[model samples]
Target: MIYLDYVSTTPLNQEVNHMYQSLLNDYFANADSLYSLGLKTSALMEKSRELTAQLLHVLPEEIIFTSGASESNSAAIKGCAFQYQNRGKHIITTAVEHSSVYQSCIQLRDVFGFEVDFISVDASGNLDLKQLEEAIRPDTILITMMYVNNEVGMVFPIEKVYQMIQKINPKIKLHVDMVQALGKMPIDLTHVDLASFSAHKIYGLKGSGVLYKKTSTSLVPLINGGQQEHQLRGGTSNTATHTMFAKTLRLALENLEQKYQYVTSLNHYIREQLTQIPDIVINTPSEHVSPYILNFSCVGYKPEVILHALEMYECYVSTKSTCSSHKSDISRTLQAMGIREDIAKSAIRISFSHHTTQDELDEFLFYLKKTLKTIKKQR
Candidate 1:
């Protein structure tokens, strides 16, 4: 199948798979154990942590490993809110944040007695820095926003937001969910206080991610057990996954410059072709989007219907967040971006990876055009 759903999860590369296999065979002991085998596993885990820290431009002590973005987000939001509640019971975030970030704050509000103020987004899905600044009260301790929106591929102005926050409240913690932006963009962690990352999104193994916190920042532990992952996340580490994650990150970075240009060209070609067709509108902004993902709406067709039609031609696409695929609700992202409900319902997301080829995109175009024609005829 032609997988156009790379944003959800990418298949593991051969090199990553080999690393997984090697770790599984040679280092199977739990890192928490005190034995020699455990020491070997612990050393491997530390090495992986160092590599991840290097990638994110943070100190190794600041990196906390977790299951994925969801857990990392939870740990970042809840951990910070709970720990710093006395400083402020208020938090700031955007209306278009991922459910992981949104739901985590909702839980904090509902269960922990914290107040969350949501900033609005512009039509292009960029957060309103002025509105965000206005939302920050004396009690406001954190600002969480996604670097790259999952559904629309909009690249939020992270540096601008950070600068705005710095001007108003230098003590306010900055948290970014960089799940979709990790390898696609160069993240210099010099400015960002805490950021969430997932290995699976970058063609690495699943169940491996990092939560990077600045040296002065403190976060409570999510999982309670042994003193691992700087004592912020506790459990026996996933040695194999960690090893593959580090190795895969290195592999992903090797061709990142080339991949960026390639994906931009591909997105431009697809956007041009699709825009030429009747009743189609590109949802993502041309200037401020990562080329890896393209979101659009077709006026005459529903997303689910077109998704199924594309599947028949062995072309895979997604309608909404894969995490909440079973929900069957309208996208919170599109809604926050002020898209009409009808248009949002008709939106479909097509994401690509380094493995995707131009020939595959051409084939997808052929099937997509045929499907659109069929849809229009029915209308």
Candidate 2:
């Protein structure tokens, strides 16, 4: 199958997989144990933490490994809310965040009595900075925004947002959900207080993720048990997953520039080819978007119908965030951008990886065009 859903999850790298198997078999000891085997396992885990910190240009103590982006986002958002609720009860975020971030904010509002302000996005999924500035109040203790939109690939101006927040209220914490942006772009954690990352999104295993919390940032423990992950997270650490995540991240960053150039070219090719098809409307903005994802609407077709048609031809794509796929409702991200309900319901996301080949893309496009023609005839 020609897989076009890298944003959902990437195939694990062969090398990382091999390393994972080896580590899982050999270092099976509990990392928190006081025994010799446990010390060695714990050492390896710390090394992974250091490597992850080096990649993000942060201290090793700042990296807290979790199950995946969902958990990391929850830990960052909810943990921050509970830890700092005494100081302030107001939080700010964008409307186009991943379900994890959006739902976490909702929980805070519903259960914890925190006031949440969801800043609006433009038609292209870009956040309104002025509106964001206006949303920030003295009680705004935290601001959570995704660095890159998962479905539409719109790249938020994170650096600019950081600067704006610092100027307005240095006390307010900024948390970024960087799962889609981690391997696809250069990430500088200089001013970012906390950011979430997933290993599976960068060709690592599915069970590993990271939450980079600056040294000064305090968070209440999401899973309280033992002293693990610097008291930010608790449980027996998965040495295999953490080590493999570091290895995969290093490999991804090593060829970052080359991959960027290659994927951007492929993205352009896909967009150009897509425009030639009648009734196709590209939703992802031409500018200020990541090259790894392309979202579009087939004017009169349901996304599920098109997806199934393409699947028969061995061409795979996605409709919305995999986390929200069980729900048949219209795309929240698209709706937040003020897109028409029909167009939003018809949107499909095609995500690319560095390993996606030109020949594969060409074949997928051929099948996609044919599938669209078939669907149109039925209509």
Report the lDDT tens digits of candidate 1 across residue range 1-379: 8999999999888878876888899999998888999999989888988987787667888888788889999999999998889898999888888899999999999998989988887898777777887787778899999999999988888888888888888888999999998888787788888889898998888888888888898988778887877778777788778766677777778778888998999999999988988878888887788999999998758788899999999999998888877787888888888998777878889999878898999999899989987864324
CA-lDDT, candidates in order: 0.86, 0.90
Model 1, residue 281: C-alpha shift (Å): 1.3
lDDT of 2 by residue, 216-315 (tens): 9999988987788888777778777887778889987888889999999999999998898888899998989999999999888888889999999888
- For model 2, the superposed segments whose C-alpha errors exceed 4 Å read 376-379
Q: Give me the overall lDDT of model 1.
A: 0.86
Off by over 4 Å in 1: 375-379
- Per-model TM-score, in order, reads 0.97, 0.98
Which number leads on lDDT?
2
Query: What TM-score would you give candidate 1 relative to the actual structure?
Result: 0.97
